[model samples]
Target: MDGRVPAALVEETGRWTFGVEPLPEAADTAARLRRVAGLVLALERPDPALDELLGALDRAERALSRRVPADPAPRVGPAADGDGRAYVDHSRHIGAFNACFPEYTIDVDGSRATGTVNFPVVYEGPPGLVHGGFLALFFDAAIQHHNCEVGEAGKTAGLELRYRRPTPLLTDLSFELTRTVEGTRIHSAGRLLSGDVVLCDARVDAARGQRSRLPAVSPRRVP
Candidate 1:
């Protein structure tokens, strides 16, 4: 079983202990779907046939629902929680509803990890800038990716961010994450940049063996 979560390798530097792990692949379907979502977000003048297109999509959704009835949520035991195979690649799994993930590819090495993303219109909040929330999300994901590879799977306990400059939309931004471990916690620092210009910087604290909060409720079934 592919580790449901990511795993990291510890490196002995003769000075400090650190970790590095391979980056996850960007799934083809997830990438394409994100592009589709971007186009939808950028749409301006409505197409004359949009109504018909919506109707056809609705019919297709209903047909699919009939063929594949909803299944109960799978039960997870405590032992199963720590199994790497139980984790899913955050950047690749389309199941997470994160359409912006396909915008980046992460690189990892013995001491550090870096990611490059091209922000599209779908992530815009200000006139020409990427959304602040998305900036936080990117930093969180980057920090978690680093920890998941080197430490036990964990969740963010705290994040502190500073937006130095506006992160422009439809432009490439670079991010770097460096980590330090103290007992059961992982501390990471990163910067989001556009070439030499610093767009944002973040510090994150992650606690090992943590799980995210449960979903508030099941999503409304389609059709």
Candidate 2:
């Protein structure tokens, strides 16, 4: 909802706890990275000063890379604690600190939701328009966010989108979503809008399953 969770809703739903709280440090770093990414795309020509920045970034990358080895493990889903309770770290649902993911925020109100997003210049596809694929990705995340907040979420069975018009980049846009639950299936429909004009719309179908039924993550050995 727009405000905090209603007490009655929490009592009826048994306290919806799915996503973990985002660390402030990680959030700050992500905001900085996003700004840097935007500037990288906005540059008109290669500036000699960028070479210095690039060298510094390369050194930082190598320094960080040496500290950890790659592990192919699922970061999302049910992780068991010592007390035998499942805890899911869904911080990445809203992009987390991952620079590759599109960033947006949604507010859930019962079966309906609303949110706003501004596609950065880095996400541009055509001349001054946001990529169609990114719009689809944003809709999927927004709908799933709405479903999870309402206490009913599942794996996406299917997703369909319709591009009514080209969505512009670097402009504030809003969206709305409505969800319906039918037995073990959840249907969510959403639309991206620029003021009153609809630029894109999406429908997502997900198959609901118990958290216990989710497969446990096993890290893969790297050679």
Candidate 3:
């Protein structure tokens, strides 16, 4: 297929609807926090002013820690919150802020998907290049995201990546993917590019299953 996203899919613009709505307040807070973390990573040297900021953050962390105990359940699947909705968390791809997750944006149409991402310094591994592990994680998220958008997704069975060139950090990069299905196996192939140069590529394999078929999350008890 051509490298361009089909005109049909381009016309269907908007965020994918497979996931439950993100909490607007939480999402905003996360975005702010992520920005701060990125800035901290970009710092050239220690600053005395950070001491006061760190102290305040410490207290805030302690206070917030008491409000929510950690739940070990996975966040993606059927009735993840016991609300009877099939939810797919796309926080890594779009919306919601996760300091550890590499941020990116994606657009999907039928069995093909495309997107752009800018790796921050925090994800750097080799000098100015992004960590190889993060690229693998990004591919997994993008492929699963495409699956969910097309209304068929499941657990990642396997993922393989080939690095052709070092992916630089703090620069805009683009990627494209095409998916094919065979029986219960879903196969997706993707390429990460800097202009016409392919920096890396991946093939992800997943098992096709219905959201209702996924194991249910145990309901949390009210205190």
Candidate 4:
């Protein structure tokens, strides 16, 4: 069983502290994930992606460390118990979200907003298609904007999606959110557009729930 381990680790690192040994005799899917993890751990030479991953992790650590943990609410905002809506600036939030989905952008229309996301091979899953899980995330984010018209201070209660076609890798896909209602329950619809073709449609149901009892931030007025 030790021989099943890769030479890169056994020869260089000598012993790996994987915490748990692989039980390949288990289900094939889990078995395969473990095998990949072993190979990944055993690599000695730094792959191009390794640097990107390390950089991302480092940035994430710094961001989390910088987050204010002492406050029950935002650092420079209204009290959480207030009726203020909880929201980040569309541009600021979109820029941050771009860290993961590089090709995403915010489309502002007055107070309403929509976002467009384009995925490439770096996030590819199927042979020539984007992963369903990833597609769900895009839909969730796009539809969440529909809540902008809602009381502007609630969390999502449910999300529904219907994928119409294989979201092709490297395609210029756009997720357009159409706001429906914006009150006690925020309702919005989302469509995945590959040019003019519709690939998926989604809906979000957001309610006046609280991640905290604290009031959410409202956008600052331009000086």
Candidate 5:
């Protein structure tokens, strides 16, 4: 192969978390949640009970919100140090809501990281293929997680992706990131693969600085 890359061993480490299945108890819960999400999206015919189910779920959500109105942003594994909740790392992340969160595992090794995930039937687009937007999301997250490894966490400044082949759903997918540091900026490239096939490629540029707004300083009187 001209530019082919070999697959890395998927290891369980403290640096990895998010949608993991290490703890048997947590894994069981995550599996159930993922299955429920799949059923919610895979159905073609509308079920009469869906409305009632939604109402019940809504009530439960409201009750939970009342109990714990706010929670710290979920972190990824033990490497996470940020205080706020990370929407991307949350157990019930946006992707998880669509049934994609619980299907992946990330491995961090210094300035590099790799992830393996399988998209279910619910993430289908363009026939039996995964949607382009979702692929982008994975790439973005993979690179961001890589940036976290070098203690230079930041927001993505720019991202570019190329679709080499249609990513098939319900198949094992691999994502890899190779990050480089250039002073305050982090450059990363990621690839999505299915076995020997390259499905998508992405490059991301991230700046290391204030990820959020800086606290305002009192104005000093000047003559």
Candidate 6:
């Protein structure tokens, strides 16, 4: 069989991220893959090993992500309350981002803080069960905050999610993020617990960055 299938995919699309899914430009995956292959074949080189080809692509993708780790949008919440928790953003669409859903709070007091969100009946997805996606959100925030606890804030580079058991909507779920420093990469393990039962767990790779540094600002001012 010819390797043209994969080659054609790479040639048509210059890069996977440039022409692929979920981009602001357009959410096209199949078309992008085809384009990528076409670009690869147009090259002057002859047949290269499939493994070698994949390796080159992987390197290029990682380089792209390293340049922009996290969304630069400002998501600052309301003024901090005396207890160190405040209801700043009330999101109705994504249950995870909204503090109104489970009404959870994070205490940024240097070390790790426990985030507990009580899933109500209204948040149910399955038959009297909380949606699995919300759990991922819980872990995401928890692990992210874990890095912030120890004076090291980082963007999520990689995340591995696992669902152990069905989470009951009526119950209250508590999540905690434990941090481990492995080189410059900050590793974290997040757990979703309802009383004694384990609901879900996740392994997150958060990239360390300096909090004091600011992004390059444009010369234009916001007058």
The model with the greatest TM-score is 2
Q: 3 or 6: which has the higher lDDT?
A: 3
Off by over 4 Å in 5: 1-33, 44-52, 68-103, 210-223
Instruction: Write the residue-wise lDDT of candidate 6 on 17-126 in tens digits.
Output: 10111233222432344445545644666556645878987997899666542444322222111122112221111233332234455544444556776766445678
Candidate 6 lDDT for residue 91: 16
Better model by lDDT: candidate 1 vs candidate 2 = 2
Whole-model lDDT values for every prediction: 0.61, 0.71, 0.72, 0.52, 0.62, 0.53
How many steric overlaps are in each model, in order? 9, 1, 0, 3, 2, 20
- Give the worst 10-residue stretch by lDDT in candidate 3: 2-11
Following a full C-alpha superposition, what root-mean-square deviation does model 2 have from the true structure?
7.3
In lDDT terms, which candidate is top? 3
Kindly list the per-residue Cα lDDT of model 5 for residues 36-91, writing each as its tens digit. Answer: 66787877888977787789889978896765315454433331333333323322
Off by over 4 Å in 4: 1-98, 101-103, 110-115, 149-153, 209-223
Error of model 2, residue 145, in angstroms: 0.9
Output the TM-score of candidate 6.
Answer: 0.49
Q: Estimate each model's TM-score.
A: 0.69, 0.78, 0.78, 0.51, 0.64, 0.49
lDDT, model 6, position 115 = 71
Model 2 lDDT on a 0 to 1 scale: 0.71
Per-residue alpha-carbon lDDT of candidate 4 for residues 1-223, written as tens digits (9 for 90 to 100): 3112121121142221111122233235333433444455558887987677678779977996665243334322334333332233331233232334333666745335666776655456778778877777776655544443232424568878888988887666776776654557667677888888989887777675432343233332222
- Candidate 3 has a TM-score of 0.78
User: What is the descending lDDT order?
Assistant: 3, 2, 5, 1, 6, 4
Once superposed on the true structure, which residue ranges of model 6 sit more than 4 Å away at CA?
Answer: 1-102, 106-112, 216-223
lDDT of 2 at 124: 87
RMSD of each candidate?
A: 8.0, 7.3, 8.3, 18.9, 12.3, 20.0
Question: How well is each residue in 85-182 modelled by candidate 3, as lDDT tens digits?
Answer: 22334523553444566667888888898999888777789999999999998888888878877767777999999999999998999999999999
Task: State the lDDT at 177 in candidate 5.
Answer: 82
